[model samples]
Target: MAKGLKKTVVLVGMMGAGKTAVGKAIAQILNVPFLDSDAEIELAADRTIAEIFERDGEPFFRTKESQVIERLLNDERCILSTGGGAYMRADNREMILEKGVAVWLKVDLNILWQRVRHRNTRPLLQTANPYETLRDLAQTREPMYAKAEIVVEAEPGLSVEQMAQKVVDALVAHGGIVKDT
Candidate 1:
């Protein structure tokens, strides 16, 4: 299945868009490696993303995020799930475009909120009003995410496997990243 891959498929979107889950499913379907940039960063730093942000600040964390993304894009042709903010940086966007195909998992704000509200793993949502924060972040990031090579709508009714299939179908129809296997 890996024989037809030409570039990495980088999943980008707001938190709770199921990037990691869908990415895993797609990688499994395609028989390719699956990587999550946030998980990679946490492993490299020997700490969680929240701890990295709290200890070194966002700027520092973003620096590391950029480096990790750059490395991942260059490392292999696989499915990569990036952090919510990863595509916001111009440098990261450039690298992703150059070396990989960015697939935005387009999910609405309300659905995103429902999926993420109970999760304490998101450091950015630890705020006085997390819903408002998420809304603002979504508004700010949507335009940039729209610049991705492929956009896959994430319906609330779709299971993770279903969403992954939707993305795979899009990639196949678009004929940009994932090659026919």
Candidate 2:
């Protein structure tokens, strides 16, 4: 962790855990650019995530996702917010860890359900039993998410700003901002 190396702050967590919102706040505080992988994918594909999944399928969307993430990792400084499923893939997780410090925006399942239930765009939650699907996804991803360099709890009652500050504080505490290699 040298002082000259580009520092990247990457946020990973379940859907609706406020990664995009918090990543923006962190970027503003750190005076760096914020990049959301999902948004980048949408921009590159010229379609929404739901449309990509529906028209091309999950595999296609994931390929695009990995590509976007790889490009972003080349940056020297950025606050990156990844899709919920991104870290579940081995290569994605390894690339993030190698290129930057990853922060897990942890949120409880109940809170996640409340935030995501009405969003039909979430392919995994589009099942007839969304609750069960969410529960399963959360369970499966929690361990992987926990492997992040830092973990910040996204409490239901806390404002996005508060969570953002918490992430920054955690980054500072964990020696996340390092010099270039």
Candidate 3:
């Protein structure tokens, strides 16, 4: 990591894992722009994520997601929070790894359920049993998420600010953020 080179910090994890919130905080701390993949998709498609899923389908949504992510990766300095399923795909994960540092916001299943249970927006978890769905998804994606350069656990009792600070620290520790000489 050259000090003069621009760095992009990409946050990857399950839905409701606080990637958007924490990524925004990290970007503010680093004084850089923050881009949420879902928001970008919504802006480009002129429809909410749920609407995209409903009207088109997961495959269609994923295609748009890949396009948005590809565009975002071109930014030299940015904090990007990707959709939950984005990193699960091999090509997407490889692209992030090649372009920047990927950080996995690891959250426990119980905590994830608590945060997202009431939300009706998650297309993947729209099942009759969202908890089980979350558990299965988490299990399946854990290995993929582990491929990230940095991993920060989003524990209970930590404010978003605290989580953001932890992410910054992890980035420094993992050599993701190099100080300009």
Best by TM-score: 1
lDDT tens per residue, model 3, 1-181: 2233257888999999999999888887777788999999999989999999999999999988988898899866688999999998888988888888899999999989999999988989988888999999999999999999899998789999999999988887877364553
For residues 34-84, what per-residue lDDT tens digits would candidate 1 score against the true structure? 999999999999999999999999999999999999999889799999999
Q: Count backbone overlaps in model 2.
A: 6
Candidate 3 clashes between residue pairs 3 or more apart in a chain or in different chains: none
Q: How close is each model in CA RMSD to the real structure?
A: 1.2, 3.1, 2.5
Candidate 1 residue-wise lDDT at 171: 86
Better of 2 and 3 by lDDT: 3
Candidate 3: C-alpha lDDT? 0.87
Rank all candidate structures by their lDDT, best first, as comma-separated numbers.
Answer: 1, 3, 2
RMSD to the native, candidate 2?
3.1
lDDT of 2: 0.86
TM-score of predicted structure 1: 0.97
Ranking by TM-score: 1, 3, 2
lDDT on C-alpha atoms for all candidate structures: 0.93, 0.86, 0.87
Task: Specify the highest-lDDT model's number.
Answer: 1
Instruction: Residues 9-57, candidate 2: write the lDDT tens digits.
Output: 7899999999999889877766678899999999988889999999999
